[model samples]
Target: MAASMSVTFLDVGQGDATLVSADGHHVLIDGGQARDDAIVPLRRKGIQQLDLVVATHAHADHIGGLISVLEDKPVDTLWYNGDEHTTQTFEAFLDAALDSAARYVEPTRGRTKALGGLEVTALHPGGDTQGGHLHDRNIVVRVSQGACSAVITGDIETDGEHDILRSSIEVDADVLELGHHGSRTSTGQRWLEAVDPDYVVAQYSEGNHYGHPHGEVLERVERAGAEMLGTGAHGTIRMRCSGGEWQARTEAQGPVVAGDREAEAAPGAPAEEPPATEAEVGCIDLNEASPEALEQIVHIGSVRAEAIIDGRPWSSVSELDVIHGLGPARVGDIEEQGEACVR
Candidate 1:
């Protein structure tokens, strides 16, 4: 088989989990909040063993699901920033890491290694933690194969961005994983200018309480003339690169031309699945439905109903799978009942 590399920005609901594979060797960046959020996607890709695994930081949203991955899969090497954290999730991750078969390494800046056929360079956490904040202590890494490269920024804020810039690390890449879930605090003008990415992926949940990929950051990315894709609206974004060229595909939106700057589906592309009819509309349109209206569904309670309301503007009702604990059977039932509608 020709050497191929791909990255999957998993939609783990307000968390970050990316699977990077090059020529069949795999390295899991950050496992999201739930076990299936990480494992299901891995199993689907037919990845039973991980060559390397990285926990950028100790935050639950970043490393929570990694515990399950460590317990379930065979990982050869586990890399993490050596920042001390006391949260139960962090402690559990540590225990799992210690017990797993993987060799543990706390990588620092200026280190370079080969993962399968890809080259990886550590570009952040040059030294001790900054400002005593976990977000500031994030580990940044760049993965490259031939002319294609990607930078994975692990929830680092503006200060961390500056730190990377000051170190003169090569931040330029074809794909830039937006820092801090596209929070205004990251992806500053200078950083975007330096990267000049062809595409950017913001890993975040739709309708999350914390507004991510903030308006200002979006404007900055547009100004940089790079295509932006969010896990929130786009679902899982997959990029496959061979030679010097790459193409992106989404779970729902279909294939995305790598150089296309459009943030959403093409202008003439179908905007959404056909809307529920007036009779069906009597039940509820998920995008427009109120919490009270959603509660009328068979298994939907006040909490789930509110969650459904919060996760709005569904391009398809299938997005309900992003909601924790809502499986395909439940989603199918909801769709059949026609009680919870979608645009």
Candidate 2:
């Protein structure tokens, strides 16, 4: 019999969590908030030991419930983006991970891990990448089994999306979990075009405070002509692939046609404001950003971050060449990344 892979998107309220299993191997990505039930699916499926567990980033909504998973389950390995948060939830998660016997790994772009019939590839957070807003530093991974693939994005916004593309990662997939819970800040037209998924899943609460699955994002998904599924509307989502064919089924219903889930706006209410794209947002302003924020840009670490801060009010991205350790070649890399700006 041919191998089969199953990807389950848990209904973790306004957060992200996914379970992928194939040939007796299981990988859980981004457990939801502390209040959510991220463990129910594991128990329901009789999965006792996880081969791999990934915390895409350190946000409470993304890694909060993972604390319990590490504490209770037998996880062989744990991969995090190395982004840290000061929240109690993050501290607890770190503690649990330290206490567990799982081998810890900080995945960077281009790293791939294989277990059983599945291949997991990290697509974001480049090797020199560090210290930015949590969303920009999100760890995006693409899970593949045979010919089928799914890209799992954890609250990654537009800049992060562009970084993945700029890094030349292959993102085309059969399934895509929408970024930032389908907010306008993510799922840009270019990103949608790059991934070109057959099915897209949005993981957010029905009446979330953030009003996820924004009208613009819905329109983009509709325009791309991909089937749309939501944990809020569909409960839990599961997709299976075997013999190179992929199919999606949700807890409430099967796959939904793209145009069916349009966002409703109040009469005369203005549309949700769109977020700045890579071009529009320009880049991390060298003069304004603190050392920590400057460190988020590729090729710039704590030392360079401080140097740039000390040389305040720079004129252009080209001026970065003057900073110590950043030669013409490194400056070109920063320009190619499109992540740093002077103004």
Candidate 3:
């Protein structure tokens, strides 16, 4: 059989840059900052041409480097939410796409494309929905090669995850790129009960101004018994799903597994589900983060903030990062707002 697709979580600091390679084809999901630095990583992956590009949303951290990619190389199809967000950043992104003759496909439910071993479908952003909730309106992609499959959630927040769960679609997968930097807002309890990913990751910057991988959010991921690999601490997380076995490059403090977790018999989580909102959030809390937490939050995306708050108790006033969204910079900003705790 031919080779399987591999997913690489590029170390773009607090931003996101993922490359999916299958059967010698390339698919990029959210590039890094505007410096065009992600190209080196793509070259390392042996990417000759980009067959597909998925822009989760118009956030600069995700779309900035895309300018570089387009300027430097040729890409076939670009999948993105086409709403006129109108920010200078968003406009620049639009201008870049128009500069190229590549097709711009609006992200919608059931939009499917196949390139060699990679088969990807848009499973979220259904019609008859409000478009303003951009984070929740983020696209969710289902990709598979041979016996292994992965789902990429683009900045999808609690509302989006819960909505997908209530739908009649399927959320089964070997690996899941956590939405929104693991901000407690995106991965709500029901969302976890639904995805149940075997391997998970959060793409954030090291010593980021924001304390990412919220303590409670990390606990939630651990509670699901998923193997979590983060870019901030683990470097670039790489995973290959083939022949029902999964292998990943990790920097875990403990032992690591090189294959997929056997949750095979479990029902594929519901995908075409309805949306739900959050009860509380982590950014609202300030005491939980460590000193390393302060820098990462400056460019924290909105996806994870949606689920940052679960129905859990703050062990003490110290776990400030448990609240939704406020990572390092926000906490500092919050203190500037006269809420800095005696940490």
- Indicate which candidate wins on TM-score: 1
TM-score of each: 0.76, 0.74, 0.72
- Superior by TM-score: candidate 1 or candidate 3: 1
lDDT of 1 by residue, 1-343 (tens): 2345677789898899998876446789999987677987665444678988989999999999999999999999888988889899899989999999998888878777696568878888887545778887788889987777899998988888888888888889999999988889898888888888988889988777888868889888877878878888777777877666777767556667866645265211343544223223233567765453454454566688778877776787778878877899978766665545564
How would the candidate models be sorted by lDDT, starting from the highest?
2, 1, 3
Candidate 3 structure lDDT: 0.66
Candidate lDDT values, in order: 0.78, 0.79, 0.66
lDDT of 2 by residue, 1-343 (tens): 4566778888898899999877557899999996446775565444578999999988888998898889889999999977778989999999999999999999889889998668999998888665569887788999998887999999888888888889887989988999999999999999999999988889888878788889889888878988777887766676777766665555454443334544322212332444234422324578875553465456776688778978887989889899988899978877766657765
Off by over 4 Å in 2: 254-343
Number of clashing residue pairs in every model? 1, 0, 52
Best candidate, lDDT: 2
Question: Which candidate do you rate higher for lDDT, 1 or 3?
Answer: 1
| Angstrom error at residue 93, model 1 | 0.7
* Superposition error at 16 for model 2 (Å): 0.6
